[model samples]
Target: MPQWSEYTDGERIKILRGMETRQSDLAEMTGLSLQTIQQAEQGKRLTLRTLIRIADALGVDTSVVLGQQAPRRSMQRDDRAMVRDLSRTVHDTAAGLLDITDPPALEELREASKACWDTYWRGSYMEAGALARPLLEQAAARLHDQPADEQAEAWGLLADAYRLAAYVANLIGSRDLAYAAIGHAQHAAEQAADDVRRALVMSGRSWVYLRDTRLADALTLAERAATDIEPKFSTATMEQLVAYGSHVNFAAVVASRMEDKERAADYLSQSHATGARMGQEYRAHGTVFGPVSATTQAVGINVALGETGKALSLIGDIKPVHERVLSGAARNRYAMDKALAQADAKLWDASLETLEGALLAAPQWARHQVLPSVIVSRVATGSTTRLRRVVELIGTASSTGGFPPATPRNAL
Candidate 1:
């Protein structure tokens, strides 16, 4: 099979412009013409190897083009780089695990994060701190010894990494860890008073809150951060693009969580406006702004809030938007919301169907914890089996938590 490197510049350019271009985007920093880059993507008649030049120019390792790496260039990617690469791998792996909704992918992703964490430590932990508490912690240490003037950049990286970690952790039933990291990110960003860092920490964690409509602290912080950062960041820098879009999406999700349908709709409209402003898409890089419809978030919120008919109507309007790069786990999370909405409608059949789909979509990621805490109050004694599975999964992830299915079905 022809590798991406073998493609002419044209084909490479096409992929570069895709949603999965975390690495490819860096390639464009080479100052090459669009036609030449496009030709390199297609492996057409070009004596000049733009991909290599592109990679070199951007200070990135070429393997990022092949999907084996996340970013091609590293600012100081040693252990920090390892942690980041592993964290992203962990995020995507968790998603894959969730999509399978089984132990295999969950086990695999869990193991991968563990392995990377171990490798990262042996390579750099002693140099940074006594332990590898989380990726965010490591990122923060880089700033501790730096001069006050030079520490802002490190702080920004720390805040972003922590928020990203928290977002991923919450999806995998690691809520406490998620919150902890976000808190650390919040503190670090505040200390730095860095607009980009503060914006990232707030908006990133808020994205998780948007899921349950519970992470409002995240959105609130993001909005404030956006306001602070707006004057500091020009439209030319990617930071402005990221910070602005984050607030738009945060507002949409926060409104949904609050059950203010009108507000959610308005915020989503604002988010789309910002989306149009982005020169390129992140390729499912739901990190900045996402495909999350106000309708989808609202439907889930209404279901959680006991407005079943409203939830159903909103869900019906959802356009079946799915992302290729958002991670299987995150996708499964959306499915869980859909199921919960069905359950609220007392469409027991619909609810059961939704649950079944959620199971099939993310058996492992769907552990008992994913169920709404409020569901327990609404559901009868007979439906506890489904609840038990979720409980057991949470226990597994917990350094302190597990559940014994009341009826002991070996579903795994």
Candidate 2:
């Protein structure tokens, strides 16, 4: 038998989906849309949750599907495999532990849940996804056994876990998983009757919409979420500050994506105001928000608006001191935005340099993201050492096949 790792994900799926099981069968069993199954079979990206669903439906260990790591054609391709394998392990393990009648110790559960956030912020999506499943399952089980007095607290924790799962799923390109997870989070938050958590769930939903390119829905949801949590910066707790600021920033990003510069700028101004109140970057509810994050995100927004000079200026204003404090994912995203700015300025070498740094910082995440592919497509065709290294890291010119064209200099 050929090693599963030797084949691309689509090929592996085809192999597993023998004559006995049709694509429709897998889709039905996994609770995934036929489109998702088809995409996976066509070698398009599938999220961790989707991969887990498929593996479980097929009744095989995830390792059977993933096999040992092999050379992938591109970073995007590699990420699809990594997330799929991790998702399988998480779901399979969680399924087996579902019969436990007793709740886990609260402190242990808290620590485990915290670890998931830390892992994700550090840009280890597979590790975070693995941790999230147990945290979500165990906390959800607590809802059945915990005392009535502790029910609200249990629900709150479960909501957080669900929200974390949603975030993890989103990171792994599990669109449907993200949707379901956020829905659960919202329900749990409602059960907990926590206003703050409810608002956070709304923001999470907005994030899902953003990922799906539902820009109008994302903007509307984000605005509503921000309004729900608009605390007075002076008297608000750090957590409140972060949540409100993050929601507003998300609204700004959505507006930018929609090419509504006026609305985007308005949202950015609000975000800046919130950031000024916070005075520094603050993280809460698995989101990081403040002056630095706002400024960094704004660079991308400006780039989206085709204001490359403004984006470059924003890049210049950011100090190394602030850069060092960004999480690995944030740092890489900022680098890609900077590279986009450079590419627009026709500084191809500088753009490549920025992308090289980003690839090294978070290679796994980089491989799955479109930004790296976009940068590579726009770079000069000549083969320099840096270009060759980027090709090695991200795959060939063909890896970006069928991707939308580069944003024109005057697209906005």
Among all candidates shown, the one with the greatest lDDT:
2
Give one digit per residue, the lDDT tens place, for model 2 in 314-396: 99999989888888778878998999898888888999888888887677666446677677788864349988898777753
Over 101-209, each residue of candidate 1 has an lDDT whose tens digit, in order, gives: 2122223333433443343222222222112234333444445445788766565555555555565444433345566666766776787677566666766567555
Q: How much is the lDDT of residue 155 in candidate 2?
A: 83
lDDT of 2 at 156: 83
Model 2: residues >4 Å from true position, as ranges? Answer: 1-97, 381-383, 396-412
Segments of candidate 1 deviating more than 4 angstroms = 1-141, 144-149, 164-183, 190-193, 203-223, 226-242, 256-262, 275-288, 292-295, 302-314, 317-325, 372-412
Root-mean-square deviation of Cα positions for candidate 1 versus the true structure, in angstroms: 20.5
Per-model TM-score versus the true fold: 0.48, 0.76
Poorest 10 consecutive residues of model 2 by lDDT?
A: 403-412
Instruction: Kindly provide the TM-score of model 1 when superposed on the true structure, using C-alpha atoms.
Output: 0.48
Candidate 2 backbone collisions, by pair: 75-367, 76-367
